[model samples]
Target: MDLYITEKPSVAEALAKYFNSTGANFKKEKNCYKDTKKNIFITWAVGHLLYQNPPEAYNPEWKNWKLDTLPMIPTIFKKTPYAAKKEQYKAVISLIKDATTIINVGDPDREGQVLIDELLPANKKVKRLLLNALDETSIRKALDDIKDNKAFSGLYAAGDCRSEIDWLLGMNLTRFFSLKAREGGYTTVMSVGRVKAPTLALIVNREAEITGFKTQKYYNIFAHLKINGVTVKASFVGDRITAKSEAEKIVTASKSSELKVTDVFKKSNKQEIKELYSLDTLQIDADKYFGLSADDTLKTIQKLYESKYLSYPRSDCKYLPTSQFTDSPNLIIAFNEAQLLDVKIPLPNLRPPVFNDAKVSAHHAIVPTGKIPDLSTLSKNEKDLYLLVLKKYASIFFPVYEYESHKVILTNGKYDFTFTTKITVNSGWTALYKNMPVSDDAEHEQDNEVEISTAVKAGTAYRVETFELKDAETKPPRRYTEGSLIKAMNNIKGDTKESNNILSKIKGIGTPATRATIIKELIAGEQLSKKGKTLIPTEKGKNLIAILPEIITKADYTANMEILLDQLEAGKIPKQKIITEVTDFLNTIIKQKDSLKIVNKDFPCPTCRKGFLMIKYYKDPDTNTVIEYAKCNNAECNQITPAKNNKPKIITCPVCKKGFMISKKNSKTKNIFYACSCYPDCKTVLSEDDFNKKRG
Candidate 1:
């Protein structure tokens, strides 16, 4: 039997459809689709079914975190089936064991290559299929041109090194900081990771800047002048004045009512359409236009890709390969037939800015599959995003935007004022968006308009009607939204000179595939919160950063590690070297863990009067709800008491007005229930449904 393993079930189904299209009789089976005549079997794994073994897997003593076992380095890392995905693993194993030949049809990336390659049996002959797009044509082409699986061995090695290193660092550091914080009387789990810590630091640092910012008052001097029956507004040439008296002096110094135009520079410029959508750019555009979070936009685009409405969504490249350009006319025809194109714009003979093979990696920029989608079937957000991608793709065929820029300098006594104006000579590419809704990107909007007549010459003199001094204040830096945060993560570079050049060349912090997961993990761990579109670090997040070493919190550290991984992927470095370096780093962190100090406020233990209480959080397994508590520090007395929920909650008990409703678990059954905090005395309990209705 010939077996094909894909990274996702959707991809498997798409490939199965392609095989069956040529009159190959294929039938869906228990865990795979079978084509008996062609002797082919297609199956998929639900992402990664296998993950690195937890710390406990190395040794039972590693299960309980203690300062003595601070650095638990596994001599030999092992792989095990993910607890939640064991069934899928078993099915895949069974299929692979029985197959005579195997084809690795995973996504075209390091992670994808490792995910399937690690599971293949060494006895079976293996081939690799690299698909840039999931459309029928692309799928068929890839199927016809499969390569040896060993071609991607370097990618697998890089991925393996990354996974093992992350596990080692995350396991040791999370326990180290968590226990250290506990020693300082903090009860919450201080979760830390290689990528997550630095990402959190970004938010925390921004918040600190916002908090410590002192607004400075400033003033601007504006002069209103009339030129050829048109009023032109000009501002003082230099920086804003810090003192009101200084601004007043400038206004007073301009005693001459008539101002002469000393210089006028006019030039025509052209602006090409914005680059095509990479996952980062698409996420940014989605957030700017529709207030969609990075996670939401990724999910939507992935769905569209799986549905065959768009190409791959996790691509980092923003340029199409030369091969894809060959199909541009067909794509345009499809768009026209689907009414996605307003005007039938002919494809330019010369190559546009969007085409370049040098910029294409793994996959090309995200574009439609030329498969017309049913608009009615798509959700509102999906339709919006599809249209957004379509418009960007169509823009390359349109003309370049042409505009004439004019800069004017006016002199009033000692003060020289400057004004600028722009006139659109031709809309060109921007004409496609004439009827489209305005984007939320502030940079997309034209600057302040200054009306000027055509008759006005460079040497012409105009009368200054009035001068106004405007008071302004320097604003604090804005907080990161999900979209901007992703961009920052993608663009972040090392701060130090040692790793600056290498880190600058590589993608920042996380890969396009993992960035969404990183943000989601931070949010799930209560390290970050979303208020509208802004991502704010929580107290827990801030505290984690406070206790971590500077090296762990800097993007440079992670960027340097990423560089090593890239080197491993390119075969420039050995996998064992990366592992050895990580192990050494871990040992150093463990040795220095004792010196780190965390200052946590202490509370007297209610259960044990002799011990100071530490704040700890307990997550209920059944309900997945986290409850904070005050835990006794004494090992002998080890008593836990529920901490008060001081944060504002919408739910309050009807029976006892003084107590709020909190989620509590049944000690014996381990079932979650909502009950009044007054417990034994008031004894008011409700189910989740009842609580929701009562709150309503």
Candidate 2:
């Protein structure tokens, strides 16, 4: 009797139906699918079957973050039994005890491998069935080729190494920073983590660029050209054009010159539709076009996958595996019949994207379950996300859009100017994306030599209807859209030298299954905010990085750690060594705290003009207490203040001879108060009129 264990019930349910296990009796609490025929029991674990606990679990004082207990290193890490859904874990346990041979069916990724590795019953006959798609065909195929769990020993090691490294680096550094901040009298929650710090660092850097940006003015020459009575506006070239006098002279000469055909050159180019929708690509498109947050996009995609309307939503590859290609056609037909196209642009074609097994590493790119969704049944967001998937699916079978590209050159006084244009020949896959506006393409159609109607020679002069000097400004870096940030995270080349090492070895920023969660964590932590789909770093996030260690803030550092972890999982390296090395590295960063100096320009201490006000504590919104406090840098000054207990207090002139006392909330309703510390001495109370008084 054989038993299959998946990661989630959603997947198990889908797989059970495909297997047509008529005698299988389903149980939710025990999370088992008992098949009477084969006498097999299948169960699943929701995410991690076990997790790492704090060092204090073994040594009590270590649980509480204390500076004296710096570099709390744990040898021979212990795992605790933890299940977010306890009932599911119970069912899994029950199934595990009864199964003869267990087949693991987690996501075919590094993390997934670790998830299953920790859950199998001790000393049991366990086989790994790595299948990316939960479809009946893929599952049945995986069952036929089930591999020994020993084959993934290296992968399991890597996952273990990654967790340990994060623990060593994150827990130690976060504690070190917190203590350093406390000693310095700044009460901010100084934190650092392998991925969290680097990710936070990205947002912080972006914020700095935006805040410090300086705009510069530039000039350019624009002209309207009339060729065969059709008008086209010329794109801006550099102002001054090196030969401004020549340009002006030519403009004067062209005002009265007869229009003539100039030399025309043409070349054909094909606009290939993007490779099928990788989870990253799909999330990106949804963010750009539909303004969906990366997290939201993943959630929506997951629902679609669970509904059997799409394949796995956590895949990184956009190409289908050669093995899965056999089932692609039927999936396409199912999608069409399901009318998934009812809400989106009509399907361009039903063919699957090109299958390149080399590119299909862990999982094939996201595609339809071949079951089109019922538009009326889905929410607005589900519909929008479905549309994106539908279009991507259709694009694979559609022919590439073909265009005739043209380059026209004009010369005046030995100064030559060139214009490029593309004339659409066939809509092809672009038909699905055509209704969308040309967001960044600024040149007008009339200015382009689209399907040039005139056969103009290069030497022939053309009349310029009008000319003007256009003013322009050097633009600062645009704020990060969820689409762009995801790209940055996935950047292989990396934006900084330190990050390059990590980028070189790592395939992408983070795994597809975890990327969305990382983004959500940042948002939840208030390190970033979503102004629509644009992720902007908040002040708190910026301050955190400004005072964090260089090692933790470097994205490449995180990437390098990830690679090492991967190596560990692959059995290329020992987990203990990686953990030890990381733990030591973090301790070194802590020892160099004198180098990091945090400055607050406006946050000044109320007691002393020389001291800056520092945030001391963090309290839950619903329950407020004296959670934390920051102190002034000057120890002699001894400037310290307690955080407001819940909501701020409003009192009448305790000291004020006139006027009233008042308190106000910040943009997010945090807290602020205005009162005289000289309550008994000066008795000066705060006044609404005085508050309303403008300050520069």
Candidate 3:
């Protein structure tokens, strides 16, 4: 008899229902069921059933902060004992005790591998069922052909290596920094991990870019042409007229001369619709269109997918396999949504869903279940997300969108004017997106709409309708918006560029499941703040990175570690090798005591209300300040004020001498209290309504 254990109760229940097993018993604490004929029981563990603990567990005094315990490397890391979990742990142990055979049914990835391997008793015999998608078909197949746990020894090694590295570095470095600071008031939670540090660095780097950007000026030449009494717009190619004199000369040259059509090049092109929404891609789209954070977007999509309104949402692949193509029609039948399932889904005679097999990683791409979404029952946000999924699925059978592209070149002797236009030959899958407008923050926001003129011969001539010099400026790199950041992390851009090549080699900074959490952590840590859809680093964040060692803050270091992790998983390198490397790296960073600097800025302290505030920058021991109230630095007559706390809080107005309170929540939550910091002299105060409407 074999007992299968899954990572979550939801998945176990799903499998049970799909099999139509009778006399199944469900318990939250035990999360198990019995298979009467075989006397086998199936159970589950919430996320990770076991985890590494603090060094203090071994030596009580080790809990205390000290430089002597700088590198606390454990020969063998301890597991979170059943004694701690008490109830669930007891249930699992009992289930294991009675079982002759155990099947590990965790997610098909590193984290899942660790969850199962770490919980097993030392001498227990176990097998692994590597199931990627939590679907009935996938689950049944895995159960029938269960592989020996030994087959996945490489995967477990990688997970073990990852855990050990995080523990050695995070535990030791956090302790090293906490004890060294003068505030001696240790940070309740000062974390440093492989992904966390580099994630924070992304924000710190962006903040520097925003602060150092300097504006520059440039110019261009423009013309408004007339065709059969209708005006058509055109511009000079490239920055052909940067200087004022050059622009004026081009404008002057176009005024009198005939706009001769020196050359006309035309070509017809076609574009295949994008495949489907992977979780990352969906999150990127939501951030651009709905201003949803990556975390929020994931949550919404997960709900929709689990509710059977969409296919699997955690997929990394954007294309489906060819094997699933024929069954696509039956999958559509399960959908209850009226938008689709009602209309005949066109099934084009295309190759199997399988394309290049190498493109698939842990799972296939996200798709619809062919279930029609009931738009009326869904929230506005849910509906919007569902529609995105539905449209992408429907587009699978769509033909390529064809267009006739024209490049009409006009030369007034030396100064040339060119007109380019695209005439649509076929709408294809674009029809699915016709009702949806382009997201406001869409990438590559080029002007797609152009006035198409009648085809011109190679040597045609026409009069110049209008001409002028248009002033412009060379803009700096755009800030890191959630959409663009996701793209960067995924390395979705083309290869050939060096920076992109570097990004491609490295696994993404965080896994798909953890990326959203990482972004949330940055915001909660106050390292990054949202400026509309863009994530800009805070002043404190910049200073934090400035003080840390270069390796601690750069993406390249994280990427290199990722390479090692891959090697560990393939059995090419031992787990201990990478774990040792990370431990050594953390120790080197902690010892760089003299390389640290902290930036302090002054503000009227919110906590004390009378003194100027001194912001503490670095977390390392060398930089700590002792200032209770936000106070003025003057020794003789120190004035202090209450320092503002984190997030939305109440504050009194300094100007107008009014005793009103202000909060930092959404505009609807703002009060009328905030005023100028000039005290009674500048008696200016704005109403809550007025301030709420003010654009930051």
lDDT of 3 by residue, 127-153 (tens): 987765555555566668888988887
Writing each residue's lDDT as its tens digit, candidate 2 over 1-696 gives 677888877677777776665445544334566667567666777778678887888689897878777777876777876746666666677677777888888777678788887777578888888776655566677778889988887887787677777777767877877676655444445556667777777777877888899977655555567665666555443344444565566556545433333545878898776578888888777876777788889999899888878787887878876566666566656666665553323333343445675566667778776566678899988987877777777777777788777777664443345566566778777777766534331322354344544444556677667765555566667777777777777874555665586675565556667777877877876668888656887765776787776766766676667666766766677777777677677677767766665554435554556876555556667787445444555566655443343111223354453433433335585645455554456555444445334210
After aligning candidate 1 to the native by TM-score, how far in Å is the CA of 618 from where it should be?
A: 13
The lDDT of each candidate is 0.80, 0.67, 0.65
**Residue 589 displacement in candidate 1 (angstroms):** 2.1
Scored by lDDT, model 2 comes in at 0.67
Better candidate number, 2 or 3, judged by lDDT: 2
Q: Model 3: what TM-score?
A: 0.80
> What's each prediction's TM-score?
0.81, 0.82, 0.80
Candidate number achieving the greatest TM-score relative to the actual structure: 2
User: Candidate 2 or 3, higher TM-score?
Assistant: 2
Could you give me the TM-score of model 2 versus the true structure?
0.82
- Each prediction's number of clashing residue pairs: 2, 35, 35
